[model samples]
Target: MLFAGIKTDIAVDMEPQLIPLIDSLPSTVPFVGPEALERKRNRAFKARLGANESGFGPAPSVIAAIQSHAGEAWKYADPENFDLKHALAAHLGVAPTNIVVGEGVDTLLGLAVRQYVRESTPVVTSLGAYPTFNFHVAGFGGRLVTVPYGDDREDLEALLAAVKREQAPLVYLSNPDNPMGTWWAAAEIERFIDVLPKDTMLILDEAYGETAPADALPRIDVSRPNVLRMRTFSKAYGLAGMRCGYAVGAEKQILAFDKIRNHFGMNKLTQIAALAALKDQDYLKAVIARIIAGRERMVQIAAKNDLAAIPSATNFVTIDCGRDGSYALAVLNALIDRDVFVRKPMAPGLDRCIRVSVGLDEELDYFEQQLPQALAAVK
Candidate 1:
């Protein structure tokens, strides 16, 4: 009746066709959030130690700023993100021209991918690196070439080799890398950059920079056109929900994002929150200390359970389950069944571990108590 004379099946058949690349891609996403799991289980997690988000909520000043600016939500944010850009410029010792603010690193990655990737253009990344980046590459019709992690860290030399062999226009690396939570020294990273081909653009994701050691990050160099350093307030600043992030690079390279970036994509509240967070360096340092203490506690728990935690420079620790992938998965499921929300890498070499994030004292206490039971259940 809705279609009148036309059959329902005929109407369905007349629906618009998807582009070839989109149609070819499998219907899947990069990560399944804890809320989705909660919905499926009909309950909430007792301990939320997954997704690497800071359980130590944002600075009090940041919250005050958000509350103060709540009324401004009725209006659109400044499309240029002018004030936030200049604030970030002052903080990072770079000019406003070197910065491009976006909804988050994830959105910026998509924009970067679109800028360089055409149909079947090669892209290089670590095999078990950030899946969101891989998702962006696939969506933009780029061929992904991956090198495996070496010694639990991104093999910079191997990544360079793949970039050269594939002549990839774009490459991605997360310092203090995710899932495994390992990092390389700044000097070594600088050496890698020196050898990289000039034509290849590097997306240096430093989302965990604040939680990492002082020497872990390379000094900001806006002179390099090929490197884009992506940072987010989500990790240490506790603003993942706000979704504010920015990338710093050479002037021309940063400006390139304007061609395809969603001008008004950033939420107004996020700008207010990030600006306040930047102004509170004292709070940032205090949170970083707590994260370090939490990391140490996580390591001790793993040891107590006869498991080993990979040394972490990020806010999360990836615990080696000392077994095969299936065994590790069982441990992860056992934790989930106990209302402990945690995650694990799914890639072959990295799947033998489960990742846990730093949380409040009580949450970690819950994790500590339940982890032994989870292991017992798995065994």
Candidate 2:
């Protein structure tokens, strides 16, 4: 007992202060992966459609390449990433100097933001587009100016308007966008690019390019110093686990990546696997055809429940649940509870839809069997 205001002293331990910059940042997890879901549910998902990954898997040649290169894992990957870049350039009909390969589109995005954005630098993207880009912007203390989707598609006109008005140094657009597999034809994207401010750098993500129609992708224009076209082995190449992707741009723009990117981030096996995958065009075409059929099957499944599936140019189809975000969330949770993994959009107006990736026939059958029960549970 103390007579004064202060009590008797004991041992005191002071906690260490975190970096002010880190303290200022909010705690967040950008994406909840399938592995995390499996851990949380304490069971493996019967049908994995939540992540928009290609279920058809990588080409046999690619797998063989990986197997062959498995012994090379002891050595670090080439810092210059020369062979991969050269192969990608040749594949894309560009000079080797015009390409930069990174861990994945996500990592490349972080590098792009780091190279351009500083504290308070303006960046523009759709309100409901890829969240990873927004996450990178926040990480770099960039000001994010978002425009909403128009009829489930990123409004190219509105995005350009925002970039101009804000004089934003960076802008992000995902063709055949995630959470809503909508896309614009190449002509529209080219027009959008033509109107963008010269100083503004555009990160055009074509992660699902392999699944999209040829006309849906704009012709490669490496002369445009302001535009960077990103492609991923994660989607159609079925190499998401390998984390391989590349960005094509003008020589100078591509070189800028070297300034801030992790030089040895690319794995040796991944390089070999992607190169093999690139050479197997027949496998890719077959996978795309299968994806188209799977999308049609998903549409029929939605129609069976009186829901309308949005037209998609990507591997996944966004089905309008004919309700609000809460209803969609309920439906998503119901499906998850049934061991059929799926995902839904969290942004308003677009949140009435649940995005499901193309899985195997058996997986889709599981989804079809569980859909009515999941809907009933939600209702």
Candidate 3:
């Protein structure tokens, strides 16, 4: 009614059409971040514990390195990621040829999916394991075959069986899994790998590997062509703001990534930060100690509230709410309303739990103070 001779139609849609695979996909994010929740409630959270981020912060040396490289931001990062790879190779006891650096674990995961997943290709993973992997698979038009978590752990045998049954090329396993914080011993993982078909690929998402016990990670061997181990600086290194991660695999498999990878995805500053972080193993050990202490505190808080805190090998703890999904969700909502941010599992078997990331002592104190009231409100 307001339009005059000028005439205004705001919506304009004419471009080369989106590919059918991409157009058919649902508009969804892998995770609705804490920032989004803060916006929705129109108030900042007292404790940011929803996302599994390391609040301990990066080492001072890492920060200094980033600062040193700040002026060099105009220069595109080395497309080869040469220096970082060499450093990682020396640190990991592997050759530089085995490494493929990318923006983050998320981007590397997408590249892996692209390499192995195609329209109608079957991919296997635990039912509620990392959602980002599944998001990538769906975007690539792959059929997801998820096995149920058995005893709060990714059922490795079940996953292997499903992979065999479906003849899937790609399978994902998150050691010290998200949402549950459960893990499998490295020996068990090695056995599973030994049995997997040679042609099949395993995408091992080891984003939490830095916080896990040493034995929890299998030895790095670039001889295995079918396995890709992905790790990131975002977790224990506390460089979530810097987009950097790398994968270790056989040389041939690693070289294949060069085909489709974003050549300049690595930020110059991020490379410097990651290099500094790798050199500062002492700082990493201190952070891990603090994370373990914080986890113990979280467990104590949960127990005080009469909830069962699951044993965690990661930087986060999943507290069992001793009820159904609805009740757990109610508790989650109550926490949100009380200015505490936390998340819960939505998969069938894992739904009776809420996940909380390790944060600073004062931040966790806010949670400790608010949790009882939230539980009572839910009750």
Candidate 4:
């Protein structure tokens, strides 16, 4: 080694080479959790109505199920998720093989992106659709082609057109959407599916299906390889903390999830909780009714302040502030300052509205009391 006693000119840089893709990517987090907001404000919100979580809480049976399964925490969840899949299939009138249960609809979205998208692979969605899905597409190096919402609902025709023009491998549509809470009838969605490019795989995220009208959800048809229907226990089921959800699609398409999914990601207790929740249909029905009642109350609150609350089919309502994003942001901040938690859309066209989730009467009353002041402060 001493024989190579080199000159200074022979010395070379020792830094590791960074991936070019890493340099091209933007540093961003998709959605900021409420806990982060609490940390920033250094105060607890008197009313939590932002995340669209079911404040009504999970079913008593589900809670009991979780408690009973507490002792099973030491064991890993079943990799196959066989029992849950079977239960879901029986409930949805589909075969067990056509179902794939995951940690939540969010995780399933990532799995779907992994299965179909690659560098520069085209993916289609609405401009302000679920940000988590968009985040997954970006993480996998996919090219996103977004269509603007038409009449406050996802533009089905425009989405299809983008998918066709881009020859996109995947497309995402959230029925009874987040932020907006707008929905199309079952027939309309069916029509949209029919017109979709045969080769393009559609992800129909129905996270709020239980809250929607009976005819809002199309019949379960796992026969089509191009369509995957995603549902979650987080919304109407009130098991947001449990993190349980599933996808129903053609048997072949469902099996692809097995190639990449984190097999033991589902907590054993979550499975028990979801199963019990499913079994208690009466409780689910009651919660849905209460959510509807809450939505009506929210609408009344908005009307009292001379604001227009958009009609909703989900657990949340979007109130139009009759102004720009800045004003809406101001109103949101004012509400936050008043110890009321809420959120708003940030995309250009949709940003004029503040989205509020269904909460208890006291929470809604607090919101009602603070809303006028929030509006005046913003003004």
Candidate 5:
């Protein structure tokens, strides 16, 4: 319309420019949320047992901190993230310079990809690991070489072989991995590190670290230039909505985040929530115990159905439905239809299982009652 007078014989086009990488990208999310499904079903989920979010809730101290500081939302958060960095550093026995706080691990992952992934830059990861990380790589025009899981766990040896074979500049590993909910011991992780090529950067995602055994987490080592460890306030702290996470590595590697990170992207209240959550160690331990109990209950529910719940170091469990991907998917749809929100891994070998997040007692009860019904209906 603006060009009505100037266009004469030619038709007006209002197309905006987009980068080729983005232009070629598909508009897809890693996981469709329960809310979206609810919209389609026209009903609410009775059992919210997906997303691996803590149903135990954040520490009371964190809630209080958020309430006390809620009025200060007008101001921008400290771009340096000074208080949080210092708190995390002191807790982890590292220098503040070794920590880089971001909106969440997902954001930090994107930043990491931005720093390293150029067109066709080879990045290695388990085929069905964190899809968001893969999405970031794709967004940045990186070439992904995926290794399949071994025995329901990420094949660390295969990952190393691929990295060495391709001379990949970057690789991703999720300890206490998402979707699968399996983990490697710290000693095993150390051995994996030993074999890595010196120049390859490893993105070690430890989002479920709090729920994992202490022996599963290697001690904080900011000395490693080739590895960045990602942690979050989302899982045990029940602050996923707060969007706060941090990455730790050598000072230089941490500093690299500064070059491309959105300095003022952090919200003021999230800082308060995370700091308060960190201060309450007892609450975190209690939540961990609750998560363990919840995991047991879920396992019991699966067993009653003659299914096997995979041993999990993370907050959730992957239940083997004793069938192929199609059957597992049918069970998942059945659960969804029954107002029990759950998720499943869709990769070739991993698709025979359904993932269930730890939830409250009532929610678990709903799941318990509906799972058998779902199984029968699926059959």
Candidate 6:
């Protein structure tokens, strides 16, 4: 007898069981990386533009900082993220207590969901805004209520109505939205915030804020507990691979992250790189100019191809294919087959467009050359 009366024999088939919630969920990946597609096709893409990564890359100073800190990777990043938090606080005109830095906005979104979401809790979002937020909600078993877009833009009023009707504790909005690149003016966003229910929490994702017009972003105010504004280094700072993002809000709500967050999840190199990127505003401005120019070139290309390009505030442009969803999808697949990488929104109302990122000039040139051929193939 191994232990007095306890049976020593165990069933070999008895494995550790997943929690009911996790076991019930489907295995889903929110975004498929271009690398995976290349692997499946056994060929690399000629133009790598589907992922919305800034092909422009990180600032030179940020690169230098990462190289200088390479040897320090042996040490774990500061658990409190003290220096980066303070730097972000100074930049945003908020106290350190009002900031919480994380791996990226994606990770922070999960953390924020865990803070308020539980089994069957209501969460509200635009129908096709960002899939990762929906993934997080489903992982935590929060029931999602979606509001449809109004003219390719996130319908703020409808989202507000859903929040009230469902009494959702959490709602997400991406200004200068993803997949599609439309944005509302700052005044409209402020009006939405003013009317939002005090008890509901809003996750305002400003991942593309750097690429938007100055007036597109409202004044950053951390006074309200209901709003958590997310910003990332992935877009204009050209640090997508570095994976640094932060959320700013009232001190009390910011502090809640500490209860559930992985304290040392940040990489030392990422922290150094983010801090350095934040200091180089001149480089950022120059990159934004290039991004705007790229957007214009893409629009021109769309017009020349006889497709209509939606006005964009973000780094990507969504071009309408002048037909139904099937035709747009055929165009996208044709481009992919011809070695031009791009993506399209799959949600019903928004499915008639293909999204293209503002890649480097050469890549965009490759896309421009291949687009007509792809359209012909689809036709």
Q: List per-prediction Cα lDDT, in the order shown.
A: 0.95, 0.91, 0.93, 0.92, 0.94, 0.93
Model 1: weakest 10-residue lDDT segment is 6-15
RMSD of each: 2.7, 5.2, 4.4, 3.1, 2.2, 1.4
Instruction: Compose the digit string of candidate 1's lDDT tens values, residues 137-206.
Output: 9999999999999988999999999999999999999998997999999999999899999999999999
How far out, in Å, is residue 102 in model 6?
Answer: 0.2
Q: Largest lDDT belongs to which candidate? A: 1
- lDDT agreement of model 3 with the native: 0.93
TM-score for each of the candidates:
0.97, 0.95, 0.95, 0.95, 0.97, 0.97
RMSD of 1: 2.7
Evaluate model 2: give its TM-score.
0.95
* Candidate 3: tens digits of C-alpha lDDT, residues 1-379: 5655775665577567899999999899988888898899999999988888888899999989888779999999999999999999999999999999999999999999999999999999999988989999999999999999999999999999999999999999999798799888899889989999989999988899988888999998789999999999999999998989999999999999999999988899999999999999999999999999999999999999999999999999999999999999999999999998889889998999999999999989999999999998888
Q: Please give the clash total of every predicted structure, in order.
A: 0, 0, 0, 0, 0, 0
Q: How well is each residue in 10-73 modelled by candidate 5, as lDDT tens digits?
A: 5467567798989999999988988999999999999888798888889999999999899999
**Per-residue accuracy of model 2 over 272-326 as CA lDDT, tens digit each:** 9988999999999999999999999999999999999999988899999998999
Which ranges of candidate 4 are over 4 A from the true structure?
1-18
Question: What is the model-wide C-alpha lDDT for candidate 6?
Answer: 0.93
**Candidate 4 clashing pairs, residues 3+ apart or interchain:** none
RMSD of 3: 4.4
Model 3 stretches with alpha carbons more than 4 Å out: 1-15
